[model samples]
Target: MDFLELVKKRRSVRAYQNKSIPDRELSKILEAARLAPSGFNAQAYKIIVIKDEKSREKLGELAKQPYISKAPIILAAVNTKLDDKYSPLDIAIALDHIMLAAAELGIGTVFVGAYHNEEIRDFVGAPNTAEMVALMPLGYPADKEIAKKRKEISELISQEKF
Candidate 1:
């Protein structure tokens, strides 16, 4: 699909099939994140790929969404540099790239942030200086096309000056 179509097709998939993602596809997704532009090229972030069921269960317990544990894979995006002023922005862009790449590869992903930070930090073995940005559960979607609700252009766009 084209870029626009890919964007439109992307959805926050919460339900997934009981299957594993191939290493090739996962590598491609991570490559997208690695290639994403960062402020000053400081790519101050790291991704912890979670595949162990026990760890996924621990993470799911810390998160509001228990369904996350059902996914075959989970990616924990982390900002590796606490001193980097634009770490959050950098991670956001990287995560966006990952999601878009996954969409193009016919994989499903969802951004999950509501979780116990301390527990996640320990589970991922992140340093005390780093920050846990978000968790993304990935796999093949189990259901049909997901419907989306979007605001009209008029409500979102603005003129040169407010």
Candidate 2:
């Protein structure tokens, strides 16, 4: 799909079906993330694919989302080399790639940003030196949804300056 169409179609899916994601599909999605533009090519992001139910449950404990464990797959995205430069922006761009790819595969994804840092760090085996920026619960959505309500462009945008 075109970029605009893909962006328009993307939604933060919270409810998911209990289906295993194929390895090839997973790789393809990760490749999409890898191809995202990184600041200065820092390319400091890494993703841990959590297909283990126990680990998912553990993460659910940290995030307090029962569906996280039931989603059949979760991607723990972190910045392995976060520094004074551009790690957060790089990770966010990477996440956009992953989410768009998931949308292409008819998979659902929720951008999970609220969670205990220590728990998330342990769950993904992230180092104390790096920061975890995003978590995504990936699977077949139980029900498709439109995006949450938003302000109009006029309310959100300015001609040149605010």
Candidate 3:
């Protein structure tokens, strides 16, 4: 439960158990997002929680990630205000908070980025003005451990210059 350990433990969980996440736990995860820092404190985002099986299936099909439908819940992280400069970054930070909270609570999540915009908007009733930043599939993981291969710090960091 150390922060670094929690970061190391987080992974893109593709396989999930067919179990429901308790509402209290889900609320805690959302609270983490709610507390996340946003540019200018303009929390211009909305998380659309999809619990219906049919909706999940449609989203999975639209996103071309069938594994998403298997999740107990799917959250559409959207930029409600659609600010060109800060919307994407703000939404990402919020979802990161959600994911880390889920990891700490033993729930699993995957941040899905690629999807069909028009199809998803129509299916999910997302406003035409809003932007879908990412999709998150949340549930208990079927695979408990994921050995992630990360780049060495030496390969990634720069000392006062790129």
Candidate 4:
């Protein structure tokens, strides 16, 4: 599919099928994140791939989003550079790459931002210096039909200034 079509097809998949993503597909998704650009080329981040059923369940509970547990994998984006202002942005770009790659591979993903950060960090065994920026659940989507909703481009941009 073309890039624009891919972008349009990408959706925040909440309902996932009970199927495992192939290792090669997972690798491609991670590779996309690995190639994401970072400030000063300092890719100070780590992606924790959670596959254990119990861990996924606990993470869902911590995030107060039980649906997250349905996916076969949960990726936690961690910023290793707490003092660097660009750390969060770098992680966000990486996560976006992961999401787009997963969508292209017929895998589904959802960006999860609201969660018990400290607990999640501890659960993932991340050091105190690291901060868990976001969580993403990945799997084959159970619901294929997603309604795309967005504002007009005119409402989102200006000629030269905001």
Candidate 5:
């Protein structure tokens, strides 16, 4: 699918099937993130794809987000080796790539931003220099749901002199 279509179809999948995502498809998703552009091409995002049920359970607790433990794979976005000034932006971009890629692969992904940073950082075995940025659960959707509404363009867009 095209980028726009992918974006439109992409949803924060909350439910998932019990099947495992293939290695090649997982690579494709990660490749999308790997190819994503970063500030000055620093490419500072680090992703730890979580497949272990035990780890996912631990991560779910840390994130305190129900979806984290439900999906077959949880892609934890992290950036510790890089400086903090732009870390959030960089990780977010990478996660976006992963989300779109997952859509293309007929997989569902949920981008989760709420969680306990320190607890998740430890659960993922993230290095001291790296910090947990976000949690993305990936799998096939168990059912469909309505998309959340967005603000109107007029309300969100600012004028030149705003």
Candidate 6:
């Protein structure tokens, strides 16, 4: 599919099937994240792949989103350079790449931003130098319906000045 179509098809999946993503597809998703651009090429981030059911359960509980544990994998995007102001943006871009890649492969994902930071960081064993920025749950989508209402291009774009 074309990039625009792919982008349109990408949605925040909340329900997922009990299925595992193939290694090939998973590799592609991770590769997309790895290739994401960062400010000044400082890719100060790390993606912690969580596949253990117990850990996912704990994370889901901490996030107060039980649906999170339903997915087969949960990717934790971490900013490794806490001192760098752009680290969070870099991590967000990487996560976006992962979401797009997964959508292309017929997989589903959701960007999870609400959660207990310190608890999750400690549970995932992330170093003190790193901070968890976001969590993404990935798997075959159990809910296929997409009902996205977006703003028109005219309403979203502006001329030289606002």
Q: Largest lDDT belongs to which candidate? A: 4
Off-target runs (Cα >4 Å) in candidate 5 are: 82-84, 114-116
Please write out the lDDT profile of model 6 over residues 1-162, one tens digit for every residue.
899999988999989998899889999999999999999999998899999999999989977789999999999887888889998888889999999999999999999994338878878898876778888999999988575898999899999988
In model 3, what lDDT does residue 82 have? 64
TM-score for each model: 0.95, 0.92, 0.95, 0.96, 0.91, 0.95
Instruction: Answer with 1 or 2, whichever has the higher TM-score.
Output: 1
The lDDT for every candidate, in the order shown, is 0.88, 0.83, 0.89, 0.92, 0.83, 0.89
User: Which regions of candidate 1 deviate over 4 angstroms?
Assistant: 114-116
Off by over 4 Å in 2: 114-116
Q: What TM-score quantifies how close candidate 5 is to the native fold?
A: 0.91
Clashes of each: 0, 0, 0, 0, 2, 0
lDDT of 5 by residue, 1-162 (tens): 677887888888888988899999999999889888777787776788889999888878877776669899998888765555776788888888888889888899988884338778776788767777788999998888578899999898988965
Worst window of 10 by summed lDDT in candidate 3: 114-123
lDDT of 3: 0.89
Count of backbone collisions within predicted model 1: 0
Clashing pairs in 3: none
Tell me the tens digit of each residue's lDDT in model 1 across 3-50. 999999899899899999999999999999999999899989889999
- The predictions' CA RMSDs to the true structure, in order, are 1.4, 1.6, 1.3, 1.1, 1.7, 1.3
Per-residue error (Å), model 4, residue 24: 0.5
**Deviation (Å) of 139 in candidate 4:** 0.5
Alpha-carbon RMSD, candidate 2: 1.6
Clash pairs, model 2 backbone: none
Best by TM-score: 4
